[model samples]
Target: MRETLGAEDPSLEVTDLDAATAAPGDLSTLASPSLFGEPRLIRVGGVERLSEAFLNEALRYVESPADGATVVLRHAGGVRGKKLLDAVRGGAGGGIEVPCAEVKRDADRSAFASGEFRAAGRRVAPGALRVLVSAFQGDLAELASACQQLIADTTGDIRESTVQTYYAGRMETDAFAVADAALAGRAGEALVLLRHAIDSGADPVPIVAALAMKLRSMAKVLDAKGPAARIASEHGMAPWQIDRARRDAQGWETAGIGRAIVFAAETDERVKGAARDPEYAVERLVRFIAARGGAG
Candidate 1:
């Protein structure tokens, strides 16, 4: 969400629905241009708890999304505005839905954790990672946080005992978080999350998958001569995805993007057991992508 917001308009007004005096009418402010004609990002949090008036405003505004105004309505899911959500999701209203679904199964939670570490260029044994996930259970965010803490406190391979000692009762992280940090070239931060994730039991395959998706988006649009929307349409991706890829791909040359694709393929093989150490393979992949270069 932050990535999309930053890409569209860095200068935005953040208004929580609970705090806003005119929650419904605030949509109008976004639709109308500023006196100085500056573009804006108008983010409204807590759409799930929106009052009747606020819901109405959202429905009406979504009918014709404001030009040059990014109105981000965050819905955490519920019964209050099911119709409105359906309308928006059905594309009766424009904009995309980035779902943050809850992780239910142990396998899924483990996969999530592994992806986190793989993205950050870290390695942890599969057994250790599963133990970490069991410790966190239902709190994915905390699991990811624990991954970062683990990386900060330890070095080299993260072991099962490490997960037992530090994150038995606490810790957290996510794959998207990993990709964001990596693409932004913040290797240290990414690695911290990566270790935490692997420790918590995220699967390396999904981590590789995330990197592949990001690189594929970057490759599809790189040097493609057209409007972003048109290019995205040609590539069968959402405009926002293209927009995000463009922003994340900044400072990356065409060759770098290509090389990342190759690394992504190799990592896929390694994570699937082409190598003895899937953890090491993923770590290498993360390092290469984060560097935006091929192996020297």
Candidate 2:
């Protein structure tokens, strides 16, 4: 809720209930006119940890709140916490809940990314938005921070390549991106990002494992002949993602994907200890996959 509100109003007052110096009675005292007779806007925050006495006082105040006071309560969504939340919900009349869950949907992530860039007085291209979503792992806070960092580090419109370059270490160049590049027939770009992942400290073994997972997904989609929607629903994948996999699956038979998965497993084992130069082993695996795709 704070994040959403902060996006609109930068003058939001945030107070930690654990560190609040005043009690509910303090609201009345604070809102009282000073020697100069000037009016003030009082907004009490952090009622989640209010003491029993303070809670009663606060509840009473909310029952008939002062004429121009706004009280915002932040509570964890729990059965015990629901009492205070219900009080505010039943009385105070306005509030919003900010669930502490990571944003995973592409649309939500894109909106968050776009909002962050726009807030900083910059524009991001559509392709760049997808790149940001892919790289940032759908963490809204991290995406927001990345946008701010980019705004501070560079000038003008931020591009996809720029985001990739500046956020190489911060971003996860995981096998998902590698699979995306390879399945799209951008083997050169796939190899480049694979190297970037190695340079950025991702172990070759896990990279191989990620590749194997991608191959397995393709194989699953290939084997399923039911409705794409039903297949995607069963597999917990977006329809569009499943659609892309279906298109990519056309180029590879189930046996071919099985071979790729086996290759990935072998590469994973080799990278752990068998292969002297793990980088070379990974490159060979990538080349073999690309060649197989080309052959198909």
Candidate 3:
């Protein structure tokens, strides 16, 4: 549907629901166009947050959407927003629900990389694809950005070396790399990358945010208190991923995790200008976390 729409349309109205509210008037304007003419496409984004009233109205319109009008809804996949999803599925109409799950595995990352290459009207070698997947890991937005950067930075075809060169300094910009290194007990390497990140002008807040996310994931594994196999099965994660998280969690007691959370909060305050030398603050945080991990 998107392919056809992209090929046939010259104009598209893509709205981000996170940035826009959908009211009855808005839907009315969408359903009934101006006296001037018709739009080629009308997309309603962030559909997960649409109000119940707006959703019902939009569903009604979907039953008989205007000619040449295409309605695209972007949902980040939430079961709590299932009411409208059920309505769309049960309705006698064509609809698509793009599930944007977080990528975590090598196979999933390869699929995404290939899809991006295809989207850009290009081809990637198998070895090059593997390199791209490893370099970008599992973040869709980052992968997409890297694809755009590569497309602009190179011509003809993208190769493994191209990916390697483009990603030479990616570790400094990628907060996940820092978290992964730290979680794997590579404190010295993580500290070096953390320092490089600060020197390369990466903001401290996002680094802290990424670290908090890693800590929270570890805490989830710890608090699950279930067998690693059971937790992996229940969470749809690989046993290795679960086991690695378990080991990482062992390096921090509950009290230690609590203190890290507090430290993150203070670092956040400092980054927001409540304190001076945000870089030094984050450096101290990294050392403190490494010390805690070493103690464990």
lDDT scores of the candidates, listed in order? 0.70, 0.64, 0.65
| TM-score of candidate 1 against the unseen true structure | 0.43
Consecutive 10-residue window with the lowest summed lDDT within model 3: 11-20
Name the best candidate (by lDDT): 1
Report RMSD (Å) for each prediction in the order shown.
Answer: 16.3, 8.5, 9.4
Clashes of 1: 19
Error of 1 at 79 (Å): 33
Find the number of clashing residue pairs for candidate 3: 0
Worst 10 residues of 1 by lDDT: 12-21
Candidate scoring better on lDDT of 1 and 2:
1
Question: Across residues 1-296, which tens digit of lDDT does each residue of candidate 1 receive?
Answer: 43455557656443333412455576777567777665666666556667788777777877887666766666656786676778778885566777877667555666677776776568987557755765575546556667767877888888878876775433222555566678778778878877777887887777777777778888877777778778765765545556777888898889998988888898898889898998788778778888986562
Could you tally the backbone clashes for each prediction?
19, 0, 0
Where model 3 places Cα greater than 4 Å from the true spot, the runs are: 1-173, 184-186, 227-243, 293-296
TM-score (all chains, Cα) for each model: 0.43, 0.51, 0.47
* Model 1: residue 60 alpha-carbon error in angstroms: 44
Runs in model 1 deviating more than 4 A are 1-173
Pairs in clash, predicted candidate 3? none
Model 2 scores a C-alpha lDDT of 0.64
